[model samples]
Target: MNITVHRPGDLTSADRAAWTALQSKAHLNGSPDLANPFLSPEFALATGQWRRGVRIAVAYEGGEPAAFFPFQRSATGVGRAIGLGVSDCQGLVHGPGFAWDARQLLRACGLVVWEFDHLVGGQGPFETGASGSFPSPVMDIDQGYDAYLGHLRERSPKFTRTTLAKDRRLARDHGAVRYVHDERDPEVLAILMGWKSAQYRRTGRSDRFAHPWISQLVRRLFHTRSDSFAGILSVLYVADVPVAAHFGLRSERVLACWFPAYDPAFSRYSPGLVLHLRMAEA
Candidate 1:
């Protein structure tokens, strides 16, 4: 096996195609998380454009791309999953039968160790290194909204009904409700960043948006439109006023839920939940 490392910006067209194909093959092996846009080549390219340390490692067997591992390499020989903080799901993309040792891959890229917090399932190499694992909830809408609603109703009837009631109340009290699944307005995205920053500050947490790169990454991503990775800004407005928003990335199939915030004044109305439900419906 040959382990080749390329800065995401340096990847050629054929290299990108190989990387993308690996992502698809990995996703089809019975796991939905592998299909996430955050794991797509477009996302790596976008991130590499904004961040300098991003790299993609493609392992080849007999001159065919068999696996792809994306990470950020620090000068100190340490590496972390690409877009570690912002990427909701993270992992190596590989063919169904390909096998590569994580330590060997790290060495080829001149890294001592690689770390991950949100590593997706099917990552065999880092499983032993995982100190703890937690479930990240996903709302599967492929079967359609009504089917998802049925599952929710069966699992948690009260929460499902309450969320639905909030949606109804929001529409009744505030004029017509408008749900935009993909809002192209830059202004809307800016407002969402501001709201999320305020949320962080009010909660006595370090505001991630305070970092210029994080903010810029979000802005650029909002403008990115592609099949593998497109920024999805789901908005909920009542009476023509913005109440809640969630900015996430989506591939053809999965939505990698990301930064979600709502107007504090509308907290009682639970516009956040309302936005998500409407988003899922869309």
Candidate 2:
């Protein structure tokens, strides 16, 4: 096998095709937490100008594409998995029989240390190279939505009952219960941003909303579609008023949950939790 490093924006069409093909075959190989659209050549190119230290490494075996690694390098001779904080899954996308050295790959990428958190299990190259684990909760939205809610009720009985009761009371007083599944509404994104920003301020945390790229990336991703991931925006309403919203990505088998927020005025309704339950149902 031969390895080659390509700048983030320099992946060719052939490389893109090969990378995506491997992604399809190894659906469960990487982290399951967050979807990295950065793995997409088009998305890489689209956000290249704003993404510092981005790089791609493509590996070939017998002159055939075998694996792809996306990473970012910092000035301190260290590299990190690209989209680290947001991507639930992190690691190289590779073919089944491919063999490569993770240390060599990082060295070739011009880094002394390569760090990753939330790495998907079975990343052979990084298996022995320093790693740890953490819990990431996932709802199986596959058995259709109802079955998923049933599981949630079993696992989180108190949370489920409380959220459901709040939702029922909200509907009774508000006069109607309405929900928009997979809503492609830009307005919903705006509301989520506002709530998220306020939450950050109230908690005395640095606001991600201050970064325009973060906001733009979320909006851009909401409209992006591919076999590996689908941009899904959903909103819940009470009496025609928007109360809760969530934005996320779903591959056929996994939903990468992201930003979620609800109108503070409806905090008594616990709309955000209810929206997730409804989403799990759908």
Name the top lDDT candidate. 1
* Candidate 1: pairs in clash: none
Would you list the clashing residue pairs of candidate 2? 31-89, 33-88, 34-88, 145-281
Q: lDDT of all predictions, in order shown?
A: 0.84, 0.74
Off by over 4 Å in 1: none
How does each model score on TM-score?
0.96, 0.87
Whole-model lDDT, candidate 1? 0.84
- In model 2, what lDDT does residue 22 have? 64
The clash count for each model shown is 0, 4
Q: Give the Cα-based TM-score of candidate 1 against the true structure.
A: 0.96
Models, CA RMSD each:
1.4, 2.8
